[model samples]
Target: MMDVLIETRGLTRNYGEICALKPLDLRVNNGEWLSIMGHSGSGKSTLLNLLGGLDRPSDGFIRVGGEDLRVLSEDGMARYRREFVGIIFQQHHLIPYLTAVENIMMAQYFHSVPDEAEARTALERVGLGHRLKNRPGELSGGEQQRVCIARAIINSPRLLLGDEPTGNLDHGSTRVVMELLSELRAEEQFTIIMVTHNHEVAAWGDRTIYLDDGVMVREELKGD
Candidate 1:
């Protein structure tokens, strides 16, 4: 039996009078790779933010691993994010002043105790063992992104959320990053929900869902 890791009912989000996301009902199975595709204002990021507990839904409930997000306080949501969701943003939000290893250790610091050994292991897992002392400015786009990936997964989050993670990479770098993510997922068995505008990138997932004007317009399984 497939375990449903994430489920949403009547999920909606609004900013002022603008509805960023229409009522959505989504179910994500454990260990599934789900891709979201949309145009500029299609609420793709909004959905991801909600799922990561970075933003609260205006209405409805999000249940992940049996915990109801709607009922969580701000601190509770923070704890939820630290314990369950790992987000990789398009910008590779690493502190420019910090070295690759330190950027990862920052995540560990926020989670609880910061362990240099574990941080080093995570960076090495992302193939950055030799670049640990390098700062973001010293790293290439792909290397910086690898640092971001290492930081995201340092806490061992159950769900990995990627918001245009490969948006800034070249073809070769994109392939490397995607393959790294796939390898990590295979070993970790975490669910992944990635938002991308490129169909080729979206095709990497097990299934794809397209959104338009805050509504889910289509969904396609990989083999279909």
Candidate 2:
């Protein structure tokens, strides 16, 4: 049986007079790596935000792991984000002063209790064991992204969302980040939904969906 991890029906989002996402249906299976691709203002990030609980849809239904997102209260949504979703952004939103491990521990603090040892292990899994004490300012672009990945996965979320996570990286760094994500996904068995404009980045996913003007225009399977 196919384990559907995420599903949306007639999902829509609006900003006053502007509709950011049109009524659309989507389904993602457990442990699937799904990539969203589009030009700016095409509603890729808007869809991601709706899925991650960062933003609510204007109308329609979204369900993840059997929970309906539209009915969740603010606190309920917060809890859902903490327990079910992990997100990475292009900006690497780490505190400038905190060390890599400290940043990871901070995420744990929000999800439950902070454990330094577990945080250390998370960083180590991303091949950053030697750079635990380095702050974001001290790390290279790729290393900083690795720290972000470590932090995102620290809470053991069921769904991982990335918004142009490799947008700021060079080719080498991008490859490293994607490879690390692939390895971690295999081990952790979490579903991934990533938004990216880069074709190379989108190609790494098992499937890709293209959005244009808030509508899903087309989709491609891995080899198609």
Candidate 3:
């Protein structure tokens, strides 16, 4: 049986009077690729932020890889984010002044020690070895995203969270990025939770769940 890697019980978040996410109970099995689909304001990003330890829930609990986020201190949560979770945003989030390899090394720096060789290897893994010295502006959109992927995985995080990771790419680039993610997942066995509005992108996962108005309204396993 697949072990539960992430679980949330009555997980909720509020922005003053606005409830961004309703009380939610969810579980994600280890090594599973789970896709989240929702319209704007459906709380997908909110949930991702909560799971990644970037934001705290106003109520309830989140447990991932044996750590209870509710019980963790601010520093503890930061450690969890650095050591356990990798996040990719629609924007590549690379520093404009940094080269591709340097951008990846930055993530390593935050995690612990930065090793240029390790950073170069990560860039190579993402097919950016030749562009190591290129800044984000000097690379194509697809290449920039590849650099982001390398940076995200440099720490070998157990959980990878993607928020519309391909939203900024064209169809071909989208396919390339998704395929690369699949390849990485196959080799690394890291659990992936991706949020996207695109059905085709959601199809890349093992299962897909749809959120509507902050509620999980539908869920489908692959081949169902």
Residue lDDT tens for model 3, 128-203: 8899999999999899989988888999999999999999999999999999999999999999999999999999
Candidate 3 clashing pairs, residues 3+ apart or interchain: none
lDDT leaderboard ranking: 2, 1, 3
- Clash numbers, per candidate: 0, 0, 0
Give, for candidate 1, the lowest lDDT window spanning 10 residues. 60-69
The C-alpha lDDT values of all candidates are 0.95, 0.96, 0.94
Lowest summed-lDDT stretch of 10 residues in model 2?
140-149
Tens-place lDDT per residue, model 2, 39-119, is: 999999999999999999999999999989999999999999999999988998999999999999999999999999999
Q: After best superposition, candidate 1 residue 169: deviation in angstroms? A: 0.8
Runs in model 1 with CA error above 4 Å?
Answer: none
| Segments of candidate 3 deviating more than 4 angstroms | none
lDDT of 1 by residue, 1-224 (tens): 99999999899999999999999999999999999999999999999999999999999889988889999999999999999999998999999999999999898998999999999999999999999999999999999999999999999999999999999999999999999999999999999999998888899999999999999999999988
